[model samples]
Target: MQTHLARAAASVDTRAAIPEPFADDALVTQPQLKRLTGDVSDMTIWRWRRAGIIPEPTSIRGRNYWRAGDVRELLARLAGGAQ
Candidate 1:
């Protein structure tokens, strides 16, 4: 029972980290990316990008931005198994 409860809490926490009503075509900036990804460090994002776990960001004016659609896909793939 405790294990189940812990698992449920963990799932909820992960979901809470991601903002709701994710617009498919929206371009998420660095800060928003962090929020969507459970406030992961910049290094983690770089690593994921390098590892091909995530698609490369669209650089604009020397800033990084990721498509919401891509992020949604990633979240679906990662959390699908747990849920």
Candidate 2:
């Protein structure tokens, strides 16, 4: 059987990936995260959070959301070789 990571990568369509956007401090949902991250799976995102590579979302009411600004900042840091 293919590994979980392999399966996850296979399910993604890199052709439809979008360019990263300039984000604000407004809260965004998982779908937005997937879009921003080039259509990665939810599981991948969860793993990123678990590994501390991504900021955890803030739970509000019955939903989870992340700050767009926080995501932008992290990505910038990573792009700058701060990893």
- Candidate No. with top lDDT: 1
Candidate 1 TM-score, C-alpha based: 0.69
lDDT digits (tens) for residues 1-83 of candidate 2: 12433443444443333234635767878887676555667887888788777788998896778887776665455444444
Poorest 10 consecutive residues of model 1 by lDDT? 1-10
Q: After superposition, how far is residue 66 of candidate 2 from its true place, in Å?
A: 0.7
Question: Which candidate should be chosen as best, given TM-score against the real structure?
Answer: 1
Q: Model 2, residue 63: what's the lDDT?
A: 75
For model 2, what is the alpha-carbon lDDT of residue 51? 76
- Per-prediction TM-score, please? 0.69, 0.62
lDDT per residue (tens digit) for residues 28-68 in model 1: 88877665655566876787787777799999999999888
Candidate 1 lDDT score at position 81: 44
| lDDT at 65, model 1 | 91
Model 2, residue 6: C-alpha shift (Å): 14
